[model samples]
Structure formats: structure tokens, C-alpha cells
Target chain A: MSAFWIATIGTSVIAFVLKYSGHSVPERWLSHPKIQRINALIPIALLSALVAVQSFSEKSQLMIDQRLVGLSVAMIALFLKAPFPLVVLSAAVSSAAVYHWL
Target chain B: MAFGAAAVANGFSVLQACLLSLLTFSGASQFAVVGVIGAGGSSISAIATASLLGTRNALYGVIMAPRLNVRGFKRVVAAQVTIDESTGVALGQEQRGIDAVKKGFWYTGIGVFVFWNLFTLAGALGAQAMGDIRAFGLDSAVPAAFLGLVWPRLTGKFERILAVSCALFAIAMTPILPAGLPIIATAFIAIVIGMKR
Candidate 1:
């Protein structure tokens, strides 16, 4: 068995706990408007932190490449409500093409 | 799921396929980790990258927690569903003022989880029969996933920063940093920045 499986499955149980444990608590404890607003913001912050990293960071030192161009186009496509597969597929095609030619 | 199939086709085992889905449970991370490990990268690197990919779930959980209000056995089920799509659906339903959004979370969670896990096996097996997964653009899958996630959250400049800052930083830093770590680093930085503000 590859190590990835060992890690993934084991983590799945742990991740499951982390994800679900929050809900079992009493609603009054969590339902406060302030808590609600904060609960709402937490994901936004976490997601922002996440996407920021994925879009730009590569193993190398701050290199912006064809992927960025593809990303911008993809974002635009998303803004246009182009649908899931299309946005990604178009970005991949354009990035690959851009890399091949430019 | 598709990634798992690809892994098996490319020489992974059934256990490997399932573990990747159950544990790593992320296509881009799984593929990258497997590719790196297959190519002789260190275990540390593979695990680190996989964990980084999984961090997005932290976002899903934080967002879904309120709506789910789930408890006990159902909480167990709901947690399994706390990925990008299910979370989005639940949040969207709430925005539309749908009642029982918590139920929607459960439904989407179970539905996507079952299909996604099954597809992991499919992808693993498919990879065995097919030569490669290029037709799927698995690498390109991450940003699309992010877009689906980030689009619904964008409401202001604050959110724009919250959403785009880490990605932009990661892009700026990816060329210099190690693979997968930059994203994690950006999240940490954002958290630190957010906490301070």
C-alpha cells in the first residue's frame, strides 16, 4: 500500500470529526448572532487564505507563468456564468496553448 | 474518484485507490502527491502537499457549521459532506432563504461523497485501461473548484482581499517556495493578518 492511502484514509476519519463535531453542540451556544456572523466569516477567511495560495504558489520562487493568464480568463468565464467544466477546460486549453506558443 | 482510478491504472493498489479518496480525498492533491511520490519525492513532501490541499475543507467546515446545526450520528454524516460543492449548495440554499438547509447539506454531502468516492475508484480503474488522464485536466481542476467556492463569497474589497490575497501571494511566491507549502503559508499569513485586524 502506498503511503498516500495510509495518510488519506486515516485523515478522513479525523477530518470527519473536525468537520462534524461543531454541529452536535447546542444551538443556543452557537446560534448567537455574533457567533453566526463570526462563523460566517471564518470560512471566508479560510477560503481566501486557501485560494490565494493555490492560484499563485508553485515550488519555485514567485514565478508567474501561463497558469496566471489561464486563471484570469477562467475567472472571467466564471463571471460570465459559463459553467464548471467549460471554465476549467477553457483555462487549460488556453494555458497550454499560451505555454506552447508564447 | 477519477484520480483514484488513475492511480490504480498507473500502478496503485485497491487500498491505495480507496485511501487516496478517503484520506487525501482531493484530486489535485492526490495526483500531485502520487506523481511526486512515484517519481521518488520524499514522504514529507507528499504528506505536506496533501495536507495543504485538504485545508480548503477547513473553510467548508467553518461555513457549513452554522447551517448544518447537525448533531450526534447525523453530525457524523454531515461532516463527511463538508466539501466545496455541498457547502456551496447549503450556503446557496440559505441565501435563497430555503428552510431545512441543514437537510440540504446532508443530502448534498451524502450524494456528492458517494459519487465522488465511487468516481475515485472509477478514475483509478480507468487510468489502468487508458494511457493517461490528460483528457480530464485534473491539474486544472483546482482553480475551477476555487472559483466555485470563492465566487459566492465575494461581497466587498475586504472579501476580495480575503479571497484573492493568498492566491495572489501564492502565485507570487510559488516560484520560490516548495510545492504545496506556499498555499498553507498564505493561509497562515492571512489568518495572522485577519486575527490582528
Candidate 2:
């Protein structure tokens, strides 16, 4: 099999392990303050990294473009506590509009 | 939902996209995988990054295990549907009772699972019909949606700073690192801060 398939299978397997381990493992082990703290912070950190890479980088190069505009608008909407769908729509529409102009 | 479209837009086959939604069932990690692959990154990196992102679900599983109390086939089914929406709904129903919590979990979990898969199929088909993803600027939707997802989570100064620093760090490392490693490296910030306290 190809690397792509290998990668996909590996990811699926690990993900299953992560999910399944929850049921199998003892709860006290996972409730440690440090583990809890890491869990809480990981989402914020990982999501932010995704936002940066997807918006600022294109094919591994940092390129400023309409995505930046869309991200800015979405960030503002999110700051205002806008609904998820609304924030996503505003970002898409704003980015599409900017892409049209450019 | 939107991820299915994004995956298709990234040049994945419809079957591949649906299989991802089916087998993986985690939206963010699935997106990360497709995003990495779309950018010509290696498969190993894609899997590693996605699994790192998915570690939280295991945390969620831990929280739900006692409350769920299933066995055999039901346990397997419960595990598959154990996601954010289900957990949130289950917790929300805590005021009612245990039965309510179970209902909430099962209903929300099954609901999202069915709808998510159906919509994923729709999105994949729609992307195929559209033919030109760039013209619609659908690419931007990925980051936009992710930003929206994380937006509410940044509830304090410390969290906000940590998020911004991670993003900047990933961007900075892009030039020096390989395709998918920079994102994986973002974990260091969380690790450092998490270990500090």
C-alpha cells in the first residue's frame, strides 16, 4: 500500500486507541491536574496553529491574501460572540468578496 | 459537514472523504489530515498531527465512561458516537436526571452522526459539481470555521496569549521545518505552560 493509505490507517488506529482507552483506563490516572491542564490548553493552541497555517500559509509559504481578510472578519465576529454558523458564513462571504475584488 | 466539502475540494475522492467521516468521525483532525495532504505533505505527518489533535476525544471518553455505563456491542457504539456535541448535550441534561443524560447522549450522538455523514456526502457531491473550488473561495472556509470553533474557547488573557503565541510560533517555524511538523510543534507551548503550573 501507498504512504497515503498507510498514514490514513495509522491515524485511524491511533484515534481509535485514544478513544477506546478512555473506557478501558482508570479515571484517576487521567484526572491529574497537569493532564487536565494540558488537555484544556491543547485545543486552544492547536486550533490557533491551524488558523494561522490555513490563513497565512499556502503550500508552505507565508502569503498574505484574502484569507487574512476573512480571518480578521471572523475573529471580530467571534470576539463579539457571534454564533458559529454566522461567524463561519461571515468569514466565507468576506473572503469570497475580497477574492472577487482581487 | 463543511469538512467533507473541504476534503473534496482538496482533491480527495468522494469515497475517501466519506470513509474519513465514517471511520475517523472527528472533524478537526479529519480536516488537519486533508489539509496536510492537500499541501503535499507526507502521510506520516498527517496521521501524527491528526492523532495529536484527537487526544482530547480520549479525555472526553474518560469523562463519559462512568456516566455511560455500557458493555459489549453497546460500548462499541457508545465509543463511536462519543464526541463534543454528545458530551455537551449529556451534561446539559444533568438537571433532569441520569436517564435524561443518557437520552441526551444517545440522541445528540446519533443525530450528529447521521446528519454529519449525510451532509458530508452532500458536500462531497456539491464540491464535485462545482468543479472550481478556487472560484468560490471555499478554501478560506476551513480556517474561518476553525477560528470560529476556537474563538469561544479563548475566554481569558492567558488563553488568548497562549493561542496567539502558538499561531505565531507555527508560522515562524514553517520556513525552517518540514510540511506538517510546525503544527505538531505548537504543542510545546501548551506543554511548557501546562508543566509550569
Candidate 3:
């Protein structure tokens, strides 16, 4: 009835189509050189953009705050090859500290 | 992260958040939906932005299809849980042989589906009780988890450069673009560089 419901249902349908179509398409097309390259790189680009936006932006404006501090800490933990949950915990703890102290 | 945001920022109900996780099963796209709605964007914009971000899962599907041959109803189940965690775990188990790969995919996919839904409900309820999500710094977990996901993949010089450039490109576009569009725009960078290489 509402736009929110419609959007939710629409997103689900779109996701299903995308996933099922992956099986339906000829295997050759999915493995094209260009497609493979794009596939390899898209995750990196998408995840990096997610990190940047989540860290620095507030709504539509570019603002920095505790999130940046959290990200910085998480980046270091990641660089050290820490466990995944530990990296997340380090970031959350650092962010909580920033929120409390700064 | 997203379920928490949906609860605190958008004032979404527990049902709404859980249904979203169940149906979409995409962390990024679900977050984009809430971000778009929280920013007062139209539903069209919300769905469009979410779909654009989800296009990558389709790519994942392509990569996983040959690796996971299925038929009939099993295809539907596989399609539902074909997410980053499942695909990543599946590929990581490639060395152990085909059985291991299948086990990895099913275990991760089912595990994430179950846990993600359960935790979404928990996060929604927690946000409802806490009243303010900022103090806990749960908001930052979205990006932090993303960073955790992407970092291990960037083992080489070129991947590192591409990832850094894309992060900069996304940040630079934040002020100019709408809430969810900046993330979507990063795909162009990958496309261009992917073409060049």
C-alpha cells in the first residue's frame, strides 16, 4: 500500500531476477574477459565507497566525526591482519571512545 | 548496522526491518534503502539506488553459477543466499575440493541468513530500547564491517590503488550527489579501469 512496502517488494524482485538470471545466462557470456575483470574489481570499488560514505558523510553533506576515528582504528587492525570480529570490535570500541571523549 | 539505522534513524518497525533482511538479503542495498528514505528521498529513488548497488550480486551469481550446478527448486534456495559471505567462503574452500566448496557455500549461506535475520530483530529491539544509537557508536559498524570485508581482498598493489582511488572518488562526490548515488558512482571507476586493463 505504502511506498516503503512497494520499494521493499521491488527490491526483492530485482534481486531474485538478478540471481536467477545468472543461472539462466549462457556460461560463456558470464565468463567474458571484460565481465571477469569488472567482476573482480566491482567488489573493491563498492566496498571502498561504502567505507568512505559511512565514515565521512552525514546524510548528503560531507562531514567527519567519530566514524573517521573508528575507521582509522579498524584500518590499522585490518593492516595487522587481525581477526574479523576483533577488527569490528576495535572499530566499535574506538568509535564509542570518540563519541564519549571527543 | 543497517537494521540499527533503520530502527533509530528511520523509525522502522521490527517487522519492517526483519522483512527487509529476509527479502533483500543484501546488507548494502538494505542500508541504501534506509539511507534514501531517512534522507527524505522518494521511494523510486530508494528502489533505484538499492537495485543499482545490488547489481554486483548478479555478477557474483555469474561467478558462482559454474561452481554451483543446481536444478529445479534447489536453484531457488541457492539464489536466495548467494551473498558476499557465501561466495567468499565457497571460493576460499576451493582448494579442499568440490565437496568442501559446496559445504562452505551452504554453511555460510544458511548461517548468515539465520544469523542476519535474528540479529536484525535484536538490533531493532535494542535500538528501540536504547533511544539513542550514537552513544554506542553502532553507526560506525557499517563502514567498519565493510572495511573488514574488503581489506583482506586487497592483497596486491593494483587492488590497493583501485580501492583507495574509489574511496576518494566516493568521498569527493558525497557533497554533490544524493545520499545513495555516490556509492553507485564508484562502479564507473571500476568499469573504466577494468576496460583499460
Candidate 4:
């Protein structure tokens, strides 16, 4: 199978296992304060990393371009508590303008 | 829909994107998969990052399991829909009693499932028709989506600081490490801080 297919299918299976395990496992195992705290932080860390990587990097090279504008606009929209779709749309619109015009 | 467009922009087939929504059903993890693979990362890296993001669903499962009290196939179905929205809606109906909780869970879970899948298909098809996705700035939309996901979760000073630090740390590591490794590495920072507290 192609790498994309492998990643797509592999991720789906792992995601299911994770969700199913939650229903089957004893509450105490995952409910510990430390474990909960770590679980909460995991997304925050990963998502933040994602934003940085997607915005500033281009395949192991740090390059700045239109994406930085997109990200900054996203942050501003987020600050104003714009709905999710609007925040994303504004960023895309702004960034696309930069990509085409500049 | 954003996922559909983003997945297409990231080189996934419409079928692949729809499959992800149908099976995985977790927004952040699904996004992580496309983001990692799109950036030229290996499948293993994509799976790891997606799984890490998925750990919370297990916690949601724990919260919903007893309340749901299902068995056999019903239990399986419950587990599949045990996401943040379902659990939150279920919990929010606490004062309304058990019947309301069950109703809330089912309605919200199934509702989101149907709409999310349909929109994903729509987004995928739409993106495919758009031809040059970069012209629409869909590439930037992916990161913006990530920002939107994490934005509401940063509810405190410590969390805000840690998230910013992790972002900076990942960017710093991006030049030195491979595509997905930098994101995975930031998990250690969170683990360390989480363990310290």
C-alpha cells in the first residue's frame, strides 16, 4: 500500500483502539490526576507544534512566507473570539491574497 | 469540511478523507495525520502524533462508559461515539437527570457523526474541484485550523505559556529534526511539566 494509505488506515485503527480502550478500561487507570494533567497537555503541545511547523517551516527548512500572515490573522481572529470557520476563512483569504499578490 | 479540503490539499484522496472521518472521527487526530503525512513525514510519525492526540478520547470513554451502561454491540457503538461533544453534552445535562443525559449523548453523538462525515465529503469534493489549492490558501487553513483547536483549550496562564513555549520549541527543532519529530518531541516537554506538577 502507498504511504498515505498506510498512514490513513493506521491512524484510524489506532484512534479506534484508543477510544475503545477508554470504554473498557477501569476509570482509575486513566483518571489519576497526573495522567489527566498529562492527557490535557498532550493536545496543547501537539497542536502548538503543528501551528509552528505548518506556518514557518518548509520540509526541514525554516522559511517565512504567506503562511506567517495567515497564522497571525488566525491569532487575531481567535482573540476576537471569531467562530472557528470564520477564523480559518479569514486566515486563508488573507494568506491567499499574499500568496498571489506578493 | 475544512478537514476535507485540508486533506485534499495535503494529497489525500476524497475516499481517504471520508474514511478518516467515518472511522477515526476525532478532529484533532485526523488533522494530525494529514498534517504529518503532508509534510513528508513517515507513516509511523503520523500514527504516533495522531494517537497521542487521541488519548483524551479514552478518558472521555471512561467518563461515559458507566453512564452509558451498554454491552456487546451497543457498547461498541457507544465507544465509537464517545467523543468530546457527546461527553460534554451528556455531562451538561446532569441536572436534567439520567434520561436527559442519555438523550443528550445519543443525539449529539449521532448528529455530529452524520454532519461531520457529510461535510467532510463536501469539503473533499470541493477542494478537488478547486484545482490549485494553494491559490485558495487552503495550505494556510490547515495551520489555522490547528490554532483554532488549541486556542480554547489554553484556559490558564500556565497552559498559555506552555503552549507558546512548545510552539517555539517545535519551530526551533524543525530546522534540526525531521518533519514530524519536532512535534513529537514537544510532548516530552508537556510530560515533564505535567509530571512536575
Candidate 5:
């Protein structure tokens, strides 16, 4: 199978397993303060890393271009507490303009 | 819906994106899968990052299982839909009593599932029709979406700093490591801080 298929199916199965495990496992096992604290931070770390990777890097190389403007606009929109859709829309619009015009 | 478009923009087939929504159903993990693979990361990297992002669902399941109290086929179905929205709604209805909780869980869970899948299909089809997503700046939309997802979670100053630091750390690691590994490496920072406190 292709890498995409493998990742898709494999990740899905694992995600289901993680969900099911929570249902079946004893509450105390997962309720530990340390565990919960770590779990909460995991997404924060992964997502921030994703933002960096997506905005700054292009494949194996780091390239700065229109995406940076898009991300900056996103940050400003986020700071202004614009709705999620608006944030994405503003970023896309600004980035596209930069890509085409500059 | 954005996921559908983003997935296609990231090089996934419409069927693949739909399957992700149907099966995985977790937004962050699904996006991570597409993003990692699109960036030429290995399947292992994609799965690892996605699975790590999905750990919260298990926590949500733990909170919901007792409140739900189902059996056999129903239990399996309940597990599938045990997401943030369902659990949050179920908990929010706590003052109303058990019936409200159950109703909240089922209604919200199934509702999100149906709409989320439908929108995924729509977004995928729309993005597919767009042809050359880069021209439309959808490439930046992917990261912007990630930022949106994480934005609400940064509720405190420390969390905000940690997130920014992690972003920089990943960027610093980018030149040295492969595509997805930098993201994985940031988990250690969380672990260390988590251990310290």
C-alpha cells in the first residue's frame, strides 16, 4: 500500500485504540495529576511545532516567503480574537496577495 | 470541511480524507497525519505524531464512559463518539440530571460526527475543484488552522511561552532532522516541564 494509506489507516486504528482504552481502563490509571498534566501539554507542544514546520520549512529546507506574512496576519487576527474562520481567511487572503503581487 | 480541503491540498485523495474523518474523527490528529505526509515525512512519523495528538480523546473517554454507561454494541458506538464536544456537553448538563447528560452526549456526539463527515466531503470536493491550492493561499491556511487549534489552549502565560519555545525549537531542529521528527522532539520539552511540576 501507499504511504498515505498506511498512515491514514494506521493512525485511525491507533486513535480508536487510544479512545477505547480510556473507556476500558480504570479511571485512576489515567487520572494521575502528572499524567493529565503531561497529556494536556502534548498537544500544545506538537501544534506549535507544526506551526513552525508548516510556516517556515519547505520540505528539507527552511524557506521564508509568503507563508510568513500569512502566519503574521493569522497571529494578529488571533490577537484581535477574530473568529477561527476569519483568522484562516485573512491569512489566506494576505498570503495569496503576497504570492501573486510580490 | 477545512480538513477536507487541507488534506487534498496536502496531496491526499478525496477518499483518503473522507476515510480519515470517518475513522479517525479527531481533527488535530487527522491534520497532523496529512501535514506530516505532505511534507515528505515517513508514515511512522505521521502515525506517531497523530497518535500523540490523539491521547486526549482517551482522557475524554475516561470521563464519559461512566456517565454514558452503555453495553455491548452501544458501548462500542459510545467509544467511537467520545470526543471533546460530546464530553463537554454531557458535563455541562450536569445540573439537569442523568437523562440530560446522556442526551447531551448522544445528541452532540452524533451531531458532530454527521456534520463533520459531511463537511469533510464538501471541503474535499471544493478544494479538489479549486485546482492548484497554492494560488489560493490554502497552503498558509494549513498552518493557520494549526495555530487556531492551539490558540485557545494557550490559556496561561507559561503555556504561551512554552508553545512559542516549542515552535522555535522545532524550527531550529528542522535543518538537522527530517520533516516530522522536530515536532516529535518537542514532546520531550513538555515531558520535562511536566515532570518538574
Candidate 6:
């Protein structure tokens, strides 16, 4: 599991930088609305990249897996404004049922 | 959460499973790595596989650094606690922040960290007795946890739309892509959408 730890440490350090960098480093706050808007996009940009990578890739293959299904169910739950716990449970149950059956 | 659940399902001893949680501390990474090793992959391959899936945590750091800049001992500890939920929560408070805004961030980040790991151990310990735990349908716990993390941040149409789109993208891609890459794609879509605006 050294790989796990390596990724953990590697990912943690980067996450720290992204999550805290704006507040941590004493960069002069930009007054430009455009710059502010662009900067604002950074977190969302990174978040999407991160989530997409995690959701789609696994074992270095490109097969549709249960995670995808579970995540889809999760999306539906969220759209319905289901409570967070319920969304999660629904996703898991749907994915598991689908995975087991198929 | 899924890591521990998968471990139990695969018949690992409680001790081994708990140790995975305590030490590995990575949900997807641990789950993916173990599956490979269990399938007879070499240590190197398993490690590489897990590392590949875990690359996002690093990006999390880059996103988190601005929100939490603790130094010295606390910095180190805070660094450890930085994960998906914590980083998102911390950053979500940026525009209309309050006194407890910082506290809210920390609560999300560190709180989830300690409890996730703790409950991970709890599940691992229950492995032996959790036979047929699938009946309880514990597999959904990770997604549930993700929802918990993402739910609180659903403030705007953009954020909500991004989240829903990504979730759907992840699910749709599940049958098409490899294991962990769906989330990556979803993340990319969100980023593009955010940048396009």
C-alpha cells in the first residue's frame, strides 16, 4: 500500500496548496473583477478535474463500472433535492444492486 | 468507507482490514490496490494503480492551501486532515465568511477526517460478524458520505448544476471507463463549465 500512501501524501500536499493557497500565501488581493472571477474559477476547475479523474479511471482501464452507476444515482438524488444521506444511500444501493445482478 | 466495505466483503480479517483503514487512510486508493493485489498483482502494480487513482488528493492540496495556512505542528496535522470534504467546505465559505466560517471549514475538514478513519476501523472490526453485510447494503456509504460533503455546498445554481452534472457523468461513464476516471471526467467538465462562465 505504499502506493496508497504515496498518492495520499502526494495528493494531500497538492490539495493543501489548492484549498489553502489563496488564504495561506500572502498574495496581494486583486481588485479586478475579471481577475477575481477567474481566480474564483480555480477551485471549481480543480474540483471537476479531480472528480472526473477519480470517477472514470480505475485499474488503468476504461470500462463502465459500478462506481459510475452509483454516481449517476447520486446525481439523480441530488437533483431531486434528496437529503445528503439519502442520496448517498440511494446511489450505493442502486449501484450495488446493479453490479450484483449484472 | 467503500474501502473498508470491500475489504470486509472480500473476506479479509478484521485486523487486516482495520489496519488498512488506520494506515492506508485512502478510500479509493486502498480499495483499488487491494483488489489488484487480491487478484495477484505485484506490489509494484498495485501501488501504481492506487497511486494513479489517488492523484486527486494532491490537487485538493493545491485548492486547500489558500483556505488553511496553518504553520508548524498544527500545519502538519491540518495537512493530514485535508481531504475532499474538508477542502470543499473550507473554500465554500470564502465570499460571505463569518467568525465561525473558519471553524465551519475546519469542522468539515478535520471532523470528517477523524471520524472517517475512526468509523473505518469500526467497520473493519465488524468484518467477521458482518457476514452478508451486503444485506445491509453498506456499499453505498462512500457515495452517501460524498453527498454529505457536497450537499452543504449546494448554494447556487452553478454549483448545484456542476455537482449534478458531474454525478451523472460519473455514473454514465461507469460502464465505459476504468474504475476511478469517471470522477476525473466529471471534475473536468465542472472545471470547463466554471471557466467558461
Candidate 2 CAPRI level: medium
- Deviation in angstroms for B132 in model 1? 6.4
Q: For model 1 chain B, where is the 10-residue window of minimal lDDT?
A: B132-141
Judge candidate 5 at residue B67 and give its lDDT. Answer: 84
lDDT (Cα, tens digit) per residue for candidate 6, span B1-197: 45566556545555556665554455555554445444334445445544444444554554555555567776655655555566667667777765344676678866776776776666666545666644545544443444444455566887767665665565465556554444445535544554567
Per-residue lDDT tens digits for candidate 3, residues B49-99, read 667667767777777777889877988888888888899999999999998
For residues B1-197, write the lDDT of model 4, one tens digit per residue: 89999999999999999999999999999999999998888889999999999989999999898888888898888888878889999999999999999999999999999999999999999999999887898989999999999999999999999999999999998888888999999888889999999
TM-scores of the candidates in the order shown:
0.66, 0.95, 0.86, 0.98, 0.96, 0.52
The recovered share of true contacts, given per candidate in order, is 0.34, 0.64, 0.68, 0.85, 0.79, 0.18
Candidate 1: residue B177 lDDT (0-100): 62
Could you tell me how far off, in angstroms, the CA of residue A90 lies in candidate 4 after the best superposition? 1.3
What is the C-alpha lDDT profile of model 3 across A1-102, one tens digit per residue?
776777777877887788778766777777778977887787788778878877787777888899888889988998898987678778877888889997
Choose 2 or 5, whichever is better by lDDT: 5
lDDT by residue (B66-167, candidate 1, tens digit) is 665556676666665677677777777876565656767778777866777887777666556655433444333444455655576677788676666655
Worst 10 residues of 2 chain B by lDDT: B130-139
For every candidate, C-alpha RMSD to the true structure in Å: 5.3, 1.6, 2.7, 1.0, 1.3, 6.9
Ranking by lDDT: 4, 5, 2, 3, 1, 6
Which consecutive 10 residues in model 3 chain A have the weakest lDDT in total?
A22-31
Per-residue lDDT over A1-102 for candidate 6, one digit per residue giving the tens place of the 0 to 100 score: 544344334443443443334334344443345444543443343234334434444434434566677777877777788876577578768776876787
- Return the TM-score for candidate 4, rounded to 2 decimals: 0.98
Q: Name the best candidate (by TM-score).
A: 4
CA shift of A19, model 4, Å: 0.7
Error in Å for residue A33 of model 5: 0.6
The reply for model 2, stretches above 4 Å from the true place, is A2-4
Candidate 1 per-residue C-alpha lDDT over A1-102 given as tens digits, one digit per residue, 9 for 90 to 100: 456555455445545554554444444654455444444444454445444444443334344566666677778888898876577667666765666676
Model 6 DockQ (Cα-based): 0.20
Cα shift from native, residue A39, model 2 (Å): 0.7
Candidate 5 per-residue C-alpha lDDT over B105-142 given as tens digits, one digit per residue, 9 for 90 to 100: 99999999999999999989999999878778888988
Compute DockQ for each candidate against the true complex.
Answer: 0.32, 0.69, 0.61, 0.87, 0.82, 0.20
